[model samples]
Target: MDDAASIDGDTTRPLSQAELDALTDQLIDKLKTVFDPEIPVDIYELGLVYKVDVSDDKDVAIDMTLTAPGCPVAGDMPGWVEQAVMEIPGVRSCKVDLVFDPPWDPSRMSDEAKLQLNMF
Candidate 1:
């Protein structure tokens, strides 16, 4: 039997709405464990993650950004996000989409993140 079937006793049952939400939450939590290496705060709290999409097939796609377009870690940040998201229990594949549409600013950061950086 497949892993999903083993977990729920039926592979055709399909992941319920609650299960999908739970899986998304799990992936977010794992993302919180990842850092930019230069920033003390997790990328999530820093307002880096803009969106997360999980398909019924267990694939996860993340849209995110960095503090700066020229940030030295640009090459590695996406990889970090992909790795963290992949650690989620039900994710079969992970992809990170880097975006700079609105641009990142101090306002995008969470209160906790601001406090950590002494921005207030």
Candidate 2:
């Protein structure tokens, strides 16, 4: 993931649907590397990531939540996510928005995440 990228000397053009999908996949892979401080599972599998949006200009936006509002890393998790996403190629910028609405629950966890935590 590099911060410097341009397509044909233009960075404002919207990406094609296929291009967006491919970039999204890459973004997910990068996101899977971030882990909750207390959880062995990555944030993606842990269900912290609620939404990922990519704009025409390749800007990235993430909507996410924490395991708990009182979690020690509450102040830093968003930045961590932003940094991770910003590292991806073609990502012009990244913004992570933390939200507790529709609050996180065990049901949100991926099957793999549940298995890893022995929640089954």
Candidate 3:
């Protein structure tokens, strides 16, 4: 689904491609501030974030996963992500969906994350 569509199937105001790109960038920056409690790397670079969607109304939706299903913060990480995204100026709302399908793998980590963890 396109980023402009809400989870409830509502369509938000239309935005220019440039505007969407800028919002996406901002969202990503906010996402970078969230970290896994057991991992030193930020979730973004760690590849925990699978997808991000933003609507013209400034609502944000994220699809993310944890390093493991048994991770201690499984119940709280989504809230952390939502709060971080919602704190951004102009964001109307933020929702995070935790997914396990196509489960997370170490190979998903970015090079920076790998380097930080000495995985390289």
lDDT of 2 by residue, 5-108 (tens): 56787545457789988998899898899999899999999999999888887788899999998999999999888888888877889989999998999999
lDDT of each: 0.85, 0.88, 0.89
* Global lDDT of model 3: 0.89
Number of the candidate with higher TM-score, 1 or 2: 2
Query: Which is better, 1 or 3, measured by TM-score?
Result: 3
**Per-candidate TM vs. native?**
0.84, 0.88, 0.87
Residue-level lDDT for 27 in candidate 3: 84
lDDT of 3 by residue, 4-90 (tens): 656586677687899888888888898899999899999999999998887678778889999999999999999999998888888
User: What is the overall TM-score of model 3 with all chains considered together?
Assistant: 0.87
Candidate 2's clash total is 1
**Model 1: per-residue Cα lDDT over 18-72, one tens digit each:** 9987997798798899886788999989999998887667888889999999999
Per-residue lDDT, model 2, residue 70, is: 90
